[model samples]
Target: MSSRSLPTRQLATVLFTDVVDSTRQLAQSGDQVWARLLDALDAVSRSEVRRRGGELVKSTGDGALMLLPSPTAAIECATALHAAAGQLGVTLRIGAHTGEVERRGLDVAGMAVHVAARLMGSAGSGETVVSATVQALASPAAETYDDRGELSLKGVPVPVHAFAIRQASPPPVASAPLPVGDDRDAVTRLLRERRYEEAAEIAPEVDAATLAEALLAAGGRVEFLDVDITLVRMLQDVLDRLPADDAVTRSRTAAKLAFELRGDPSTAQDRRDLLDLATQLAESAGDAQAASEALLATVNSLWEPTGALDRLSAAERVITLTRRTNDVDHELEARLARLHALVEVWRIHDAGLELATYARLAARLDRPELNVFVASRRGMLAQISGRYDEQARQGEIAYTNAVAAGMPDAERLRMSHLFPIERDCGTGPDLFEAGLEMLRELTGIMPGNFYEADVAWVLLTLGRRDEARTELARALPPLLTSSGYRWLFSAVLAAETTAEVGSAEACQRLYDALLPHQDLLACVGPTFGGGVGERLGLLALRLGRTDEALERLARAVGDFDEIAALPWATRARVHLASALRSAGDIEGADSRLAEAKDTARALGMARMLAQIEAEDGGR
Candidate 1:
């Protein structure tokens, strides 16, 4: 009944070789000349294959695929082919990989063949790219290699570590004195002690490769120590002197420097530029893992809602490419980047699917860092879905894991999510206050204003309007041009707090700034909460725009009710009641207030219930 044929499998080393910029060459040379040149190139390729004991599968116009007995033979043949092609005035880009392939008569098929083709595409003219398997099988003396790092080949489900086969090995360097073998630890300790000039001077005494590694490690440690600008500059100077072809070192250094710059709001544009540059370098070197990392950095820096879809698309590409390479850590990170973009665009279902994949990968990889990150994301998702109990449980797990891993920053981030969950779950303000203290400690240690917006929200809710206003001032400047979860949350908090404590002119300015983004929803958990519209309504009411206030608050109540966010819906109803009273609908106001009170009582939202009672008493 089945018309499909099963593929016959065989282990072989697949090699793909192609002419670089063939189209451009074709355009420059007429059809006849190009045809003759390709013919000559094919003749040389066939001769090399026969001489090196390989079976030529087929010619793909300007490229050819060959099957060799072993990876060693494949590299040998490729090297000879490179030399022969050069002699014929044809520059060739070659790629080789050893894996199980499907032998279908004269042609071979399978991921191994495809991966080789992709690697060839990634190679430059006169260069040969090979997978880790090829590198492992080949005799080291026969071919020197430059480790290319991990690459996500097209149609591959995982990342592959590749190496560029050098034509010859370099001459050995004269042995150095000054304990070069033990310099890595010394450099690390000096960097840790903040002795930047001393570390910089000592780093160069070791070999270039070893020094690059030391700089990358030292740079990461310095980032945790409050982002020393002077030290970053020193590291950059060292990296700049290294070989341009050293992509792995360059990509890692660029990514680390970008992260350090991101901590300072003043360097936002620099951070963006550096990340984009890093992406280009990674792509040029065919380092998909590094490319994905750069893209994730770009996603983190993107604050505009208009760019969300573009960033999401880039993240998806990285995810697909990372998955093809079978790199668990990078794949999980790419998935998380995609998930963040999904959540920003209010695509909850897609985000959930990504989370599921992330969880599976984290478990399979047995990476504690991944587990802690997954737990943090799961806790955030649970909070959005109104599963406060699950949120609290996951939050605790994330916190414990973070602490055990010595990731203080991750612990602080989880605390940020936990504070809101505690409030919504009807946990007392004492715990919320404790969470704030932890956040304050983190801010003191890190010296960043990211926590100020969260601090403002808690202060406003506790009725410390003056303190909330101060915190809002500190949080608002950098967030003015930004959009997304944190930016939206900050805007909502500023709008509500300003309406209560700031001057009418200041409140109106905040209102005007927020009006354009009124349609953007605040992501609380699994659902879009009423925070944005409700705060907008309250600000409008304060500005004597009763009609606008009622309109916005009504929409807010509907959205909250649709998601079954009882506490949020209750808060929206209370605001709607006040807006109604301002519009001279006393009876409607009474009805809305009564409904809000009942919902608050049913949900055991003590803070919300108290607010409703206070509003009623004021009326």
Candidate 2:
């Protein structure tokens, strides 16, 4: 009977680890030193194997075998095993293969057994090898692996894309480089082997200069939002480090990558980074087309609930970007020109005053589009301020022109904003409702993100969370999944509906998701949805994250102050004050509560006054 002829049966991720140059190390050190090193390794491997939910199967005198349940668990085990034996110069190389194996006596064996041993032969010391099958099982959530493109193995008729588990710093490597130029006929062979670090080295040597655009086009084939973002940022940093005029294509690449990344529901830093890179790239390229696209990309990132309105600075930066370019007459320059015009004149002053200035400017410019945009924002300011009559008039103009101009999305939104004001003032009431039904049709035709978040805001205010949730589900089309504050839409859905539906679970999950994403939202609306922070904070307080609740509620006050949402501001202050009191600062809390009552009274928010009274009474 052969010593290798043993078999063991178990469900496991089969693993292979080998130390490189073991015979040479033995030749350099005496027998006693080698024996002690082997003893140290056995002890280290045993402890680490147990720590990683692995069991030591058997010791092969020098190499030991281990088993673990999942590929992730196996990789984790192997990483720990490699570290534990590092100090003794016993450089451990491991290959993991997971499958059903036959068990006989104390030994384990299967077809994967040969494969794992063969893979271990391929790896240098201080390395771990994993198969492509294992990589597929780890997908997006598992945080480690460096692709070693493809390699051919002895007795394996097929090739494979192998991998090494990555660390913050990998061990120093001495290994053969993978040969260049992958043959199309070797797809199976490619799938079975890896030339990981070699490919990255060979990539730069490929004279990308000769095939720049083709390489870019190939790179563009990478479409995952997160991956594109990382590539874009790297491209940006690379371009920035190089002297200007060194290569125009570098900036173009940066712009392309950044623009693509911005389309993801990624981090604000990611979106903002991409936009900034795109703008800088455009400036570098001296290309009008790229500049216009980058500017629009920047604007697109800003159309979310500012809950703080900080992104208005970004929108304003686009205006500044528009001015820096030589191509002021670029066909796509209109949006920036209009945005700059609005920013110069149409922030949060009194609606009546802003309207007169907007009306004068529209007449001076003789532009209907400018008139519609400015009139709509001012009118929204009026309605939320409860200046009912002025709200009605601007709503009429914005909706009427949008219809005449064939801007149905704008028309639907304008009419939607008008409805509550009409209901309040007892005028054009049916028209607003008719406009909403019309919006359901418009939602299907609009070619953009979350035109429905806009529609839902009105629906939420109308006390229609159930109906709004249904419409919102319908309204949030594929394009809108990439929309800014998408997480906020779901949060608003819970915040708006939870009080009525009594679903604590939905509200809690919604709150949890929203709180993390909230740090970067910059609201652009004229509504006190910013005050929704107080509502959310109060919920968090009930959930026992009182410190978080207090911090969030205070931030809400800052947004309210900027937008002059006094009534909502006062309401937010009361909630925050109550939270502060609950958190043990009684004097500070009392002063805030008093100030809230005064502001709510002056702003004529009887609802807020009643709420403050209840809070004070509770205390």
TM-score to true structure, per model: 0.55, 0.45
Residue by residue across 1-619, what tens digits does model 2's lDDT show? Answer: 0011111123356776666678888889975566556655655665566665666654444666777656666666666667655656567878776544543222345445555666777776677777765666543323567887675655433455577766623222221221222222121111112222323333333333322332232222111223333334444444444455643565445544443444444444664665577567666777655665555544444433431233334434544555566333222233322332233232445334534543554465433444555556666666545555666687777667644432313444465565544443332335645655664544454223244544554465455667766654554343223443233433443454443343455447546545544543222332213334555776677666889888888987776677665554665787789789889998888999899888766655555566678878887
Q: What's model 2's lDDT at 269?
A: 65
Residue-wise lDDT of candidate 1 within 42-67, one digit each (tens)? 55665666665567766665777888
| Residues forming the 10-long window of minimal summed lDDT in candidate 2 | 1-10
lDDT of 1 at 11: 49
Q: In model 1, which runs have C-alpha deviations exceeding 4 angstroms?
A: 1-281, 303-307, 368-371, 399-418, 425-428, 466-488, 512-533, 561-566, 594-602
Give the runs in model 2 whose Cα sits over 4 Å from its true position: 1-249, 263-296, 301-318, 324-366, 420-490, 516-528, 541-563, 570-619
Collision count of model 1:
13
